[model samples]
Target: MDKNVLFQKFVAFTAAVHQTTNEITKNVKSETITPLHYKILEYIAVSQPVTLSEISECMHMSMPNTSRELRKLSEKQFLEKVADDEDRRKHIIRLSKKGEAMMNESFQRIESRFIERMEHVSEEELKEIERALDLLHSKVFN
Candidate 1:
């Protein structure tokens, strides 16, 4: 295959995935829950008791900005900050029950949308897409 054609196809695929994800996330966003808020929730949900610095690094955001978002989410009762036993100055953040429920609902919405879109695709084609995705993952990450 021509490398230029391959690159173009990859770019198109990435654009489509980004667009679909944005659309799904837009559907889930609320007054207190913007797309960025959902991203923060996702990071915290995966890494509970995480520190502010850790979240900042993971999100590729500055400490001040991360702190601001955390405060907003806390105000919304999505998460809470507790003093880290290891260090008095640093705090650990964890999602509240409300946060977990919200995250679960958002993920369910995205998954259901994906499933709805895939319903028209044949099983064999789905399997092939899965295999291709796995290959891409392995190539990119490993």
Candidate 2:
């Protein structure tokens, strides 16, 4: 196979995955919370006790914008700020119980949808997908 053709196929696969993810996440969004809000919650759930600056950097958002979003999440009772032990002046942000529940629910919904879709595939095909995904994960992250 030509390298260019392989690259095109890879791009197409990634785009499809991205579109599917967006569709799956649409159910997670609500009138009060946008997709970005859910993303922030997911990030905090995964990286608890994260500082505002760190979240801002990781999200590629400005400090003011991140602060505004954090404030909104706080008002929604999704997260809270705790004083850092080493630095009283610094605060660490963490997801609240409500946030955790929301995150878990969203994850379960997405997982169920994925499993439903994968049910059409044979075991051998599933194994091949798993292996390919593992390779892709390693290649992309490492």
Candidate 3:
């Protein structure tokens, strides 16, 4: 296969995934959380004990903006901060019990919708998808 053609196909795949995520998350609403806030929470849920700089970089947000959002989440009792053992000046952020619960519920809804949409997939296809995703995560996206 041509490299340019493969790149185009990869772009197409990413676009489709983005659209699917938007559709799936459209119904996911929180009384106090916006899409941006959920994006932060989603990251922290997966990579807890991370630092402010890490969050800011990953979210493509400014330090002040990320801190502001973290403040809100803390106020809402959705996250906890602990002093980093190695760096007392830096705080490590993690989700509180409430935050974990919220993430689990939201993820369940999203997973259900995704599964419904992929109901036509066979076991072999699912395994292939899993392998593809693993490869993408470890190689392309790493």
Among these predictions, the greatest lDDT belongs to 3
Error of 1 at 58 (Å): 4.8
Arrange candidates, best lDDT first.
3, 2, 1
Per-residue lDDT over 1-142 for candidate 2, one digit per residue giving the tens place of the 0 to 100 score? 7989989998999899889988776676445787789888888887787999999998899999999999999999989899999999999999889888888888888788889889899999999999998998898645
Per-residue lDDT of model 3, residues 103-131, tens digit only:
99888988899899889999999999999
Report lDDT (CA) for all predictions: 0.87, 0.87, 0.91
Ranking by TM-score: 3, 2, 1
RMSD of candidates 1 onward, in order: 3.1, 2.6, 1.3
lDDT string, candidate 1, 10-53, tens digits: 89988998798787666674556777888889889877879999
TM-score, each model? 0.74, 0.80, 0.93
lDDT of 2: 0.87
